[model samples]
Structures are given as C-alpha cells and as structure tokens.
Target: MASEEVVDLEHQNHNFHFENGPAAAIFSKATLPVTLKFKDVIYKIKIEKPGKFVKAAGKSEERTILKGISGVVSPGEILAMLGPSGSGKTTLLTALGGRLGGRLAGSVSYNGRPFSNAMKRNTGFVTQDDVLYPHLTVTETLVYTALLRLPRVLSKAEKTAHAEAVIAQLGLTRCRNSIIGGPLLRGISGGERKRVSIGQEMLINPSLLFLDEPTSGLDSTTAQRIVSTLWELANGARTVVMTIHQPSSRLFYMFHKVLLLSDGNPLYFGKGSAAVDYFSSVGFSPAVAMNPADLLLDLANGVSTGENGEDQAAVKQTLVAAYKTHLSEIVESELTDCSAEPPVAGDDRTLSRWSNTWVNQFSVLFRRGIKERKHESFAGIKVAQVLIVAIVAGLLWWQSSTSHLQDQVGLMFFYSAFWGFYPLFQAIFTFPQERLMLEKERASGMYRLSSYFMALTVGDLPMEMVLPTMFYTITYWMAGLKPTAGHFFWGLLGLLYGVLCAQGLGLAIGAAVMNLKSATVFASVIMLTFQLASGFFVQNVPIFIRWIKYISISQYTFKILVAAQYKVGETYPCGGGGGEVCLVEDFPAIKPVGLRGVSTAIGAMAVMIVGYRLIAYLALTRVGALKK
Candidate 1:
C-alpha cells in the first residue's frame, strides 16, 4: 500500500512535468539575439520657473539630463550602470530602452538597424517598483500576463505551459500559489515580488531586458541572487542592462561591463574588471577589500581622496576627459562594427499592439476586473456604508405619512443626492490606483485602451448595482414610500441609473487627473456644483443660470423618484386638513417638467452614463500614452 501511494505521488509529479515541458522548450528555442547600441544620446527637459517678483512668471529653462552618452551592449553581456542620485543612469537607460519621451538627440539602434517599434516589442523593461495586483496569486498573475502578452499563434495550453515554465525558471514554484499582498494584507516577501516582476518581463522571451534598480530595496543576499539571475540570463545570450547602486564585490564581478556616470556625464564606460585599472592609471586606486562598484561611484562623483589629492571638480573633469580621450575611441569602434553587421533573416515583424482580439481582450479584462473588485477592501466598506446610510435614512423618516408631504419629498430628494454623491466619490480612486500598472502593460503593447475601458465598465456594473439595490430594498420598505409593485420597481430602476451616472463622472475625474488628491479636489468641486443645482436645494432658479438644472443628474433622479411615487392621475391627502393633494398643483417642487415619465428620466441617466464614460476613456488613453 505504501509503494502504491508513492507511485501515485510520482505520477502526479510526472503529469506536472509533462504539462510544463513544452513551455521550457519554447523559452529555450524562441529567443533571438539582439545587440543594442546607442551613440551620442542627449536628453533634455523643459522646466518652467516661477519668476521672482519683478521678472516674468512663465520663464522656462532647459535642463539637460543626459549629455552625449554613448555605449554598446552586445548579446550575452550584462552592463551595470553605477552612479549617484541624479547621475542620469535611469535617464540613459530609459532612452536606450525606447521609453524616453520628448526630443532626444543622437541614435539608438538594435542589431545594426535603426531602432523601431518592432525592437520595442522584442524588449522588456522591469521598473524599480513592482506594480502588481495585490489579490492575485503568483501563478494567476503570470497566467494572466501570458494570456494577454503571448503570441496568438500559441494555444491556451501552450500559453499555460509557458507561464508554468517561467514560474520554474524564476525559482518561484514554492510560492506559486501565494497571494501578492500589499500593506493591508499578508503574502509574499519583497524578494519574491521582485522575481515576479522579472518573470512578467520574461513572458515575452525578450532579447533585450532593461531593469531600473531591481535590487533597490532588497537585502544583500537577495540582491546578490537577483544579480546572479541576471548573470545567468546574460549567459543565455540575452542583453541585460540595469542601474545599480553600491553593489557588493561578488555582484560587481558578475557584470561584464560598467558605465559610471556623474552629473549627466559619463566618467567611464568599459569592462567591469578593467575599471579599477583605468582609475588607477588616472591616479586613483582602492584597497583590495573595497567594493569596486563603490570605489568607481566615489571616483565618478569626485568623493574619492586619491593619491593626487585633486579638488573635487578637478577630479570630475579629469575622469570625464580621460574617458573622452581614451575610452571613447573603443566605444566608437564597437559601435561601427555593430552598425556594419547585416540584419538577421527571418520573420522579424513587430508584434501587434494587442495579442488578443478586442472581444477576447474585453472578456479577459472583465474577468480580471471582477476578481480584483471582489477582493478589494473598499467593496466591503461600500456595502457597510450603504447599509448604515439606509438604516439611518429609514429611521429618520420612518413610515412617513402623506400628511407630512414636505418630509416625504425631502426624503426622496435625499435618496437621489445620497446615491449620486456616494458613487462619484467611490469612483475617484479607480484609475489613479491602477495607472502605473495600466501604463506598463499598455506600453508593452499588451492590450487596447478601449478593451480595458469596456471591461472595467462591465465588470463594475454587477458590484455597482448590488449596493444600491441593497440600499433601496432597506430604505423603501422602512420609509413606506409608494409600496405598489410598479412604483417600487420604477423607483429602483431610477436609483440604479442615477448611481451609474455618478460613477461614470467619478471615473472621468480619476482618469483626467491621474492623482488621488488632485482628482478628489476636482471631483469635489464638480459634485458641489451639481448638488447645488439639483433643484431640491434651489427650486426657483434664475433664468440665466437655469441651464445648470438640465445638467444635474441629481435633479433628473429626484424628478423621476417623485414622478414614480405621485403619478399624474393619483391624489393624496395634503397637510393635516385631509384635502386632496395633486402632485402638479399642490407641490411645485416635486412636480415634473420635461422629466414626467419613468422612461425620460431613465433615458437622461443613460445619456449621462455614456457621456461621462466616454470622457473618462479618452482621458485615460491620453494619460496612458503620455511618456515622461
């Protein structure tokens, strides 16, 4: 029996291996060698300075971030960029990786040809901070990325196999099922998260990989492991360029070449092993125990107290001039040789911006959105808030009678305002929170903007509808407003539509600003404007300012709820006199003008929904495409 149990266990392991076998083969066979070369790359930014009291206020200055930097990174090489803060290592990497925005001087090429969008498709970039969905498990994260990024030519099984292979390759199999948690939740460690980031880029089987401080926040041991992984990747014939600060001696030795920068200027660009010798030739040498990376950085930044005892500025000048006079020729020679090589023959066409069709993208993104929304902390908070508000409102206006017409009308208006304001505020954080992830995926050509927008809209609808439904169900019976089935159903529909409109407006605000604080301030201003013009607060509007009433969704919702309760033919007791109260004649405030029927109010709400969502989609697309 024990032997049989062991056999069963071995069979399960065999099945797992078989499932991921093809993916390992694909990773080994699919990569193409790419050599990246940059020449005289200069990057500058325009900054506007607030002029002093007497000077012009809008004066602008051009700050150069990268000044004529040049280098070549061949296949099977790992180039480490060492520099102090603001030394242009990141700027240079961004430029070389095709992520830099604005105008850049000089040329960057891939495999002897001018850099094109095609090269970008074949390249990968790992940002310093890992931006991932906090609720997804490691395997789920990689599977989704594969589904969205892998070529359409591959089957679903093939893609799953590939994702699994990446999990194994990155040494993440042990924690594959663990959730990627954030500050609010418990999950994987920082090192594991960084590996996940690397695994995400590896999904494409990229030839060129750029990482911005992959080891920035890791412990020394973890940092060495990450660098070792890069070293292995480089040995596999991939070109890896990364910016690192103060690495250990073992990590420094793993790099094939090093580019030392100081104040946007290259002080040295050569082999990692020869950097110490070059510095020694320039009258600076470190002790045997000193980390070469630290020594180089200190020398580049003019902080090294060498044998020459030169001034800081003079030391910087000496290093920069030495590179220009001696090492620049070597770089130029390599660049010329790389540029002269012929292109590799094959189908080198660029991948499409989206791997999946629009429908598929929407479907996948919708599923992802639903998963994220279901696990979000705010979802529970929203339900709690809804229940609390519903109970409070119900108690405040308990079993309202027709004799108290003012309180009933005020209650209906309050319902409209509550639904409107709540949804608007909830949606303001949506786009801002996901902006970084969205931008990273979009820049990598993973999916279209429209697919994401539609998916988000559809996914949020079910959750969005649930809270309002709960709110209305609790408040409707408790307050005793128009208990008839027709009236209750129509009121529910109107309330739901009002919630959608408010949420759409919030999405637009979030997308437009892409900052939580700024979006909140802007949304608050708009919400206040709409609230004041909702017709409940200010029924008698001046003719010149009356247009505001037409644009206020709250006003439309209030009109619908009142019309649903007090139909044109129905009459109720007015005040305590027991006289007939006709809605059109008794209460001018609740009377419907053009928004008399349930259909008209529903139609207006639908229009607002489409208009605001369209604006939000456009704003998000614009922000996502804006490169810095």
Candidate 2:
C-alpha cells in the first residue's frame, strides 16, 4: 500500500469523525465483526411447463438454483464469487445476504448464528444494477440515504456533514454537485455513479457488505479502482462479499478468497491467487499465460477437456466431483472452527426495520419527494399543456351566456374530461417508474412503506392543484359561466376532487401491475370504460351492466361539474326581446347529470379517492414484501 494514499484515507476518516460525530457515532462498530457461514444451502422453485413439453399445460417442475453450496468468510476479508452466466453466483450471494426469500434449504448465519435483525441492521447489499434517482445531485443522494438509514440519534446537520464526508472519502468531491443522470440525462460517468451507490450503503458504515457485480460494466482500470476501494473498505473492520463476472487479472488477484460455481454446483472454494495452481494440479491448466479469472470461468463453463478425453458434460462432472472430494472437507473444517457465537447487545427498537420514527421518515421522504418531483410537476411542457388547453377552451366558449346552454355545458364537461384523463395518465406512471428504486430502498429497511406512500401522496398534492386552479380561474370567468366566487370555487373544487380520484386510480393500477407498458394499457382500457359509462356519451344503457356507472369515477366528476354550473329553474333569453325560457330537466347536458346530487356526488368522489389510494398502498405493501 502507498503511504500517501493511506495517509489521505486516514485523514479523511479522522475528519469525518470530527465533523460528523453524532451521525458517525450512531453507526458505531459492531461488538464482534460479522463472520458469514453457510452450509448445504440449496434453493429451488417451481416452474410451470407447457402441455407440449409436458403432460399438462400447468405441470410444475422444480428448478434448483443453488445446489448445497457451502463456504465461510470472516470479517476484514474479501470473498469474491466467480462464475459464468447462470452459474448460481448471484443466487448464492443473495441467499448469504439474507435478502432472498424462498423455499431455501440449509442454513445461513452471521457470526455463527442464524440471520437476525441485528445482522440485517449491520448488513449492506448492493444489487447488480445501480438503482438511483437520475435527477438528484451526488450530495443530495447520500444525504437522503444517511437521513433514512442512520438512526434518530443523529441530527439533520450531522447527517448532512456525514454525507459530505462519505462523498470526500469516495473521491467524489469534485462531482458532488453533479446530478446522477441517466441514459437520456447527461451527468456523471458510470464509475462515479457506482461509487454513489456504494456511498449509500456506506452511510451507516455497515460491518457486512455484499455487492452483486459492482464492476460489471467498467473498463479494466475503473474496475480495478472499484475493487481496490472495496478492498480498502473490507480491510477497515468490515466483511465484504461480492459477485464478479469475468474480472481482469489485476481485479481478480485483489480478492482474498474466491468461490467458483457451475450450474448451481460449487466447483472450487478457496484463495483467488491459488485457484490457477489448484486447477493446474487437477489437470485443467490453460494452454498459455491467461488471466486467472478467465481460466476459472473457463473451468466453470467446462470449456477445457480433461486428460481422460472427456466432453463438456464429463468435464463438468469431474470438476464438481473433484471439489467434493478435496475442497469441501476443507470448507467444512473452517465452518466448524468458529461455530460458537457471542451474544451481541442491541434492542428491538434498534433492530426495527425503520431507523427513524414515522414522523421523521415522513418529513425526510416528503421533502425528498418534493425535490425529486418538482421538475416533473412544474416542467414547462406540463404547464404549457394546461395553459394552452385553458386558453383554447376559453376562446371556444368565450363569453357564452345561459342562452347557449349546450356550449356552456360542453365547456364544463371538457373541464371534467381533461382533468380526468390528465391526472389519470400522469399519476399512473408514478409507481411504475419508481418501482425499482422503491424496491431497493425498501429491501434495505430504510423506511416504512406507509412513510413513503404518504410522503408521495402529500408531496405531490400542491403541485397537483396548480394546473387545475389555473385552468379553472381562466375558463370559469372567461367562458362567462359565472362571475361569482361561489360558483367558480365550487366548480373548481369538483374538478380538483376528480383530478385526485383519477390520480389515485393511476397510482393503484401502476402499483398493482408495475410494468409501464402493461400498466398503461390496463389504465387505458379501464379509463376508456369509465369514460364510456360516464353518462355523457351513453345515458340509456341496459339494466344488466348499469352498475358500472356507479363505480366510474369520471361519472361522479361529470355530475359535480354539471351541477355546479346548471340550476334546475335557471332561465335563458328566448329572443332579442325580454322574453325568457327556463332550462328544464331534459336540457342537453343537464339530463344525464341532475343538479340535485352535487353533494352526494362530491361525497362519492371523496370515497373513490380514498379507496383507490388504499388499494395502491396495499399493492405496494405486497410488492415491498413488508415484514414489520
């Protein structure tokens, strides 16, 4: 190790502790460092087979993902799993991290005991994909993470300072203000973004960290740098386990230990630098000088033939048999050596899924939601869309009097329809887009599902009203429906209520289906059905399917908007003279929606708003796999 770099890291660590004492102290080192051990860990799940391929269309088959894999990794060491694609490397990593839920056989333990909440609190799992908000700056990303993951003992200022320290520690000081942009949004490089993800886990300074393919898409230099960072972190009183897919020689040699898997079978579990020698001793050496990682992957794929003139299948069997005959006993001996655990100190509150209280979570998440969604809510295009629609509608029905009942009523219905479809489509993408990020954060036990859901719903509330309020103010008076405040505000409330209800349905559909394409299609179909049955297009339907209108949120919306403008006994000018004719029950837009049910319709829309959001919340709870 270079003295200069080590000195810089030490200085950074000292400065972090000095500047962020409260936040850093909350994540004090564990009493005993974690030692992960797994034995006979087998995982299988059922898959349905087609009738053409099996006896029945729905016949189930058990597919084994992990085949009794066993190994141990102690604290302050790097255990890297290496294999080709579909070799159960990720499966074993996930299982060892205690994040995989299934009919998992055998046992996985931390510090010689079963996986517990205490282990969970101290563990960090970084998935293969970098899940982050593209719009947030590097500083903002880590601050939010620290706020959520760090316990309540830390103040907001301390958390912020701690985030800055992490950024500096990760060498992200120059790019701290840069946004973590996505494919379309130009921002930091892939390597910096990967560090930000690691920084998120590093906020609480976990004792046990697991990363899946941290360097899957980097150049050899960047991959080496990333591995070196992990190596440094592991050496600092932490246990690091990660899955690597075909790493460079420099990157591969940094690992203290390596486990090679082939089709759910463990081919070898030993030192990384020793792997080439072990495979050579087993008669599968490369033809010339080769990267050890490459050779290990070749052996895992059974690409090399044996001295016995074996084919690929025979070669695979030989490797698996050889591991069981030689290295399996060695792994078992290591597991047996440190099987006893010392009791650790912690409480239920500390082990709880959420680090912060509900109020704290709601506050932080609500603020974050506002920060993340403000651009979407107030984007020029979105505002311009509403402004253009309002201006056009005002021009179309400009200064129309009660005499032109059809035009006035049509204008009112336009308000209902636009707000209905607008908010519906806008809110439908909310959950689908955030599904991956949401799952990542929730699985890490950052905050409760209720906190996130509530924050999202409320954070978007003020922005949700902006365009509608603007639209109503322009069209209500410009169209000459009513100059009175009572009528304008009542009609505005109805439209806004409808907007919220439609938004709820959008959220529900998005959460339930979770695929953007499929959710959009489903929402389109459901909304089209709601519009058709909204009593505007078809009022006289058969009795058999008449109940659909009762559930159509758009129908109640249309009714409320219509009732706010139209009165039962209102009179209109019949001619140029002072003669007048009263609007009857059969007036064009008045017939389907009566003026008498405005209050009841408002109540019904309120119920629908609550009901739809409730459904969305429940669907999300299931998706998050909420335990607490």
Candidate 2 global CA lDDT score: 0.82
- Candidate 2 local lDDT, 209-242, one digit each (tens): 9999999898888888889989888877688999
Estimate TM-scores for all models. Answer: 0.92, 0.92
The Cα error of candidate 2 at residue 395, in Å, is 2.4
* C-alpha lDDT score of every prediction, in listed order: 0.80, 0.82
lDDT per residue, candidate 1, 354-418, as tens digits? 45678877877888888877876356776787789899999998999766777888888887888
Local distance difference test, candidate 1: 0.80
| Candidate 2 TM-score over all chains jointly | 0.92
* Cα RMSDs, all models: 6.9, 5.7
Off by over 4 Å in 1: 1-20, 26-30, 52-58, 307-310, 338-351, 575-585, 592-598, 624-628
